[model samples]
Target: MSERTKTRRTRGVLGGRSERVVLEVLGATVAELAESGYRAFRMDAVSATAAVNKTTIYRRWPGKALLVGAAVEWMRTFVHDVPLPDTGSLERDLIDAFRRRLGIKERVEGRAWARLLAEKNDPEVDSIIGAAVEERSGAWYAMVTRAVARGELPDGTDPRLLLGMLGAIVDAWNAKSPGRLKADLLEAAVRTVVAGARSGSLVRSPRRRPAPRAG
Candidate 1:
């Protein structure tokens, strides 16, 4: 082969190897996160687990935050892309979504997520969590918009606030009790929120002016 052709082939081989190494490191990162959470996750541990040199990981990710962020993004995109189910009823759909969110605590990955949420001082990790929350909020907003169009929800429902409430409820439950969540309790909470939304109680009402006669 010509010198240029040889160089091209060499580059192709090296590119394939680099891609494989990145994948391995990311996979190992996920495993580390799942096994030890972010507080305990270490580059040396990941290097040992992935059988890749620590320098390789650093060269690609630069730091723990970037590596963890990339691992989380990959997991969210490929491994666990949880979607909000649309089953006609807004209550049912929200209950299903919340249920899935609550169920995360039952798995290793879920525990890792919980740990990350609890200890999110790192700016990069916080950014990753913010992005994930935005993505999930968008999905929930789409679901709520559909419900509004179908007359199940009030016209001016705040999807972000509603989602935040639901998330807070689940997070509180997880923090208080770390095992399997009670389905009935979750269902009840979701039903209550949905009822409030339907009745406009959850929406912020406009401020009223005092009567002029009072002056």
Candidate 2:
């Protein structure tokens, strides 16, 4: 098979007129939501982005909620099915993982998910986000599993906790410096996380309750 065919197969993109229309509209929905957020999302913009008329979008989606819901489901698949990288060294693996995730977050496709994280109230969106987060956690866990198998990390290391810490570090840096990528800082952060994991600092510690208040 050609490289393009292999890529599409890996991504699970189906072929059909109906499928094409749905995919186009949903993709446009993601881009529109990412660019304008929920309150500001416009059907006309989605229509323009998809190059399909507004009538076609409405015919399939019926309304914005349905359209966005479908878009969220598409994202769940796209985000969850991402293949993990195994670079032998935990630090290099993590750095590559972080770059892929952050690159997606800064792109039109990933912006939909970023907005989804910030979106609130709507039961449909809330449910989708909850399920997606849990499912996506497996991706992070798989990375840690590989590292552990390779003896890069100790037994019982917690992948979710490690990923959360790394995510926090990235969020803080992005907040201060925006889109700029400082390779030194990224390398330091990955090294720090690897060190912590190796030293058992990132293990899943038991929850502790506060001491009972004195009478």
Candidate 3:
């Protein structure tokens, strides 16, 4: 068999149109909700935007927050599938990972997600957001931990804080009007964060410091 045929067969293992439709609807609902304030956003509006019937919407999602929750989860979940390339260099891996995430955040759907996140205040919304955060963070943490294990990061490096730094760069990019988180910007931010992490790790541990240099 041809290599192309082999590759095609391997790539077809993921899923089908039904999955994409659900994810697309979830993303569309988020955009519609963001464009139209929560008070003005109704199930009918979501159903229409999602191109699914009210029955379908209700059947899949009991309510608006539930639907939005799914979309929020999907947005964060996208980052999980983008496995960082094993480039053997910390800077390259970090930059590539950030760039992969940045490309998603720069899109129209991503801006809508950012808007939804900014306006979130309801308790139900908070709960869903928390769950999404936990799910995606778990995945990213594993990737960073691997880097640390490979000595790409400091032994004592805080994965949580490092992840926060990466998240903040995208958040800031999304904060701008007509926001565009370009790859170049992502690369720069990754370089800076990696530099700081390396510098902090090189600092002599306070507990390990010699007593006053015997002055």
- Scored by lDDT, the top model is 2
The total number of steric clashes, by the backbone 3 Å criterion, in model 1 comes to 0
Ten contiguous residues with the weakest lDDT in model 2: 206-215
**Whole-model Cα lDDT of every candidate shown, in order:** 0.76, 0.78, 0.66
lDDT of 1 by residue, 74-126 (tens): 76874257667999988888888777766666765676676777767766567
Q: Model 3, residue 184: what's the lDDT?
A: 75
Best first by lDDT, ranked: 2, 1, 3
Report clash pairs, candidate 2. none
Q: Candidate 3, TM-score vs. the true structure?
A: 0.63
- For each candidate, give its TM-score against the true structure: 0.73, 0.74, 0.63
RMSD to native, candidate 2: 7.6
Q: What lDDT is obtained when candidate 3 is compared to the true structure?
A: 0.66
lDDT of 3 at 123: 64
Residue 20 shift from truth in candidate 3, angstroms: 10
Greater-lDDT candidate between 2 and 3: 2
lDDT against true structure, model 2: 0.78
Give one digit per residue, the lDDT tens place, for model 3 in 1-215: 99998877755742476566586577677678667745456777666766877887777778877777676667655644455567767678667666665566667555665565566586665676766556656766767677778866666667788878777876677567334566677777878888877655432356643233211
Error of 2 at 36 (Å): 3.3
Candidate 2 residues 60-116, lDDT tens each? Answer: 779887888788888767675777687777888788888778778777777777787
